[model samples]
Target: MEWTLWFSYILLSFVVITLVHSLLLPNLSKIRRIEGVPLVSVLVPMRNEVRNVKGMVDSVKKQTYKHIEVFFLDDESTDGTSSALELAVRGDARFKVLQGKPKPEKWIGKVFACHQLSEAAKGDYLLFLDADVRIQPEAVERALGLMQQKNISLLSGFSRFILPTWLNKLLVPLQHFFVLFHLPILLANWTKWPPATAAHGGFMFFERSAYQAIGGHAVVKENIVEDVAISKRMKAEGYRMWIANITSVASCRMYETNAEVWQGFTKNIFNGIGRSIPLAVGIILFYGVVYVGSGILALAALLVEERVLLLPYLLIILQAGIVYLNTREPLALAFLLPVASVAFILLLVSAMRKSVKGQQVEWKGRYYG
Candidate 1:
């Protein structure tokens, strides 16, 4: 019992400390302002982004940088998105809406659209952004400056979450925990080991040279979680990559409702964890036992007045609280970790089932599966 308690405490301590370090510690890369403001092409691949396209287009128009051209790709969206983009791009010489080429049977929707956009892009730097994300006026300038200063090839980071409901707060914010706890950013740029690769496709900037060298989006045309795969490939191929907390520069509402959240997470959860059944099962069980078992043990300790066992359980709760607080997820959701664990397993099972049946994942209105 003592050995078990000590091991659990050690694991909890390690996890909490790592997360805190990643969030609190800053990476001090020398950021330089874009020298002479290099021409940048902002490419947005859209499918049924009617609710988001106009605003994203307008946001680019408001950029502080002058030599910017925006290319919007309508990936066969049937939700009146093309009409919205047409109206938005009308008479705007800097913005052009391109009809997406037919998706090759082998290519994923985003990668195919992105590949087409890259072929048409005329900028020295290519910024791939999702239609759902809104960028501030200075974002382009800041990214260019950071890229120049850090001497890095890719600038990938997350944006602020614009959650409007409790459900969004619960599920959407859990992604912070997902990224932070699993892939700590503090150790991502260390020189000793391969950097922990991560990128939010909602906002990513890459040099045209690097993009072309890495084979562009065409390389990972079939990956469901395309961004992470791309980042990993880039890192493995020796392109410098860095991620910052870009919460101040941009914002995104990943999903509007609970159903949207479920669909969104279900599509990528398995892929994010590497599609390993044994690993996924182990994670689900690990969290279930520690988080769920701790709660039950705490309750039993309360009823039986077992102070010795209660101390460790209390420490576990403290660890969970710190994790929740740092992740910005609702603390109440901590108690439902077991439920979330089960849901994640079910999502992975669904994803694997589809993959085995020669089907892939789907998002928005398109069936990439």
Candidate 2:
């Protein structure tokens, strides 16, 4: 019983430290306007993203950064994505929809598409955005302002999830929780430490010279979690990387249904952590005790009339609240943290089971191990 109380205190301490670190996490500079900015190449790689093409093109047309060329690399998308893009960007010279070449052996589909975009792009800076992402008009201006000020070579962050379903709300925001709680801000942003890296392909901004120096996406062609892999490569080449609070400027509706959410996470979670069984076990135990156990203990505390058992549960709620506040997610989601944590644990278990089975994970109509 006393140990439970101590563990709650430890969780409280972690929450405090995470809150302090969250404050130091970079916010996109409020640079509303800029003159004579360098040519920026905005690249979007699509795979059966027909529903998103018009929206993506519309967002690009509405951007404040007019000196930009946008490329829609169609990765053999069969859902009429290429035709949709062409129709959306009709008479717009700045936007070009390129037919992506066949993905070679040992290369991931998205990475191959990005490599083609890199080869074709001619700009001082490169911005890779997923098709489902919607950025504010001033997003590029603010992002470039921050990168220029910090002299960062690569900048990326998970976009805020546009939650349209209960499952989406519960799972998507956990990405923010992991980023704030697991990643150390100073080492990831200030130093060129390869292991201390985190990135999101949803909104990756790169300086042209630094991107070329690291061989672009070719360096991490086979990596399923290409975002983090590329970021690590950037750091390995002595280039500084920055993870920003991009929720203010960007939002993504990544998965449509609960099944997709489960599958999407299962596909990347194991690979994201380097496919280490020990790490998976450790994560399971930690979540089991620290998160899921909290709710269980709280229930037991009510029956046994032991009030202290609720401490960890309440602390976790506080932790989720703080994380949501910093990440600009709906604060009301805080009340559902325990439920979400449980769902996340189950998702992790599902992910681990697949990884152990050596099964090929299917995503966007392609299979990957």
Q: For model 1, what is the alpha-carbon lDDT of residue 98? A: 93
Residue 110 local lDDT, model 1 = 87
Q: Give the TM-scores of the predictions, in the order they appear.
A: 0.85, 0.97
Misplaced by over 4 Å in model 2 are 32-36
Alpha-carbon RMSD, each predicted model: 3.3, 1.4
Q: Model 1 segments beyond 4 Å from truth? A: 1-8, 23-32, 164-167, 184-187, 191-195, 298-339, 349-362
lDDT of 2 by residue, 1-369 (tens): 889878988999979877977898988748844445699999999999999988888888888878899999999999999999889989999989999999999999999999999989999999999999999888888998888877889999988888888899998998999889888898888888888888899999999999999899999999999999999999998888999899888989998898888888888888888988898889878887788888888898999999999888889888888889888899888777778888987887787788788787788899978
In model 1, the clashing pairs are 360-369
**Candidate of highest TM-score:** 2
Q: What TM-score does prediction 2 earn? A: 0.97
In TM-score terms, candidate 1 sits at 0.85
lDDT (C-alpha, whole model) for all candidates: 0.74, 0.89
**Model 2 poorest 10 in a row by lDDT:** 28-37
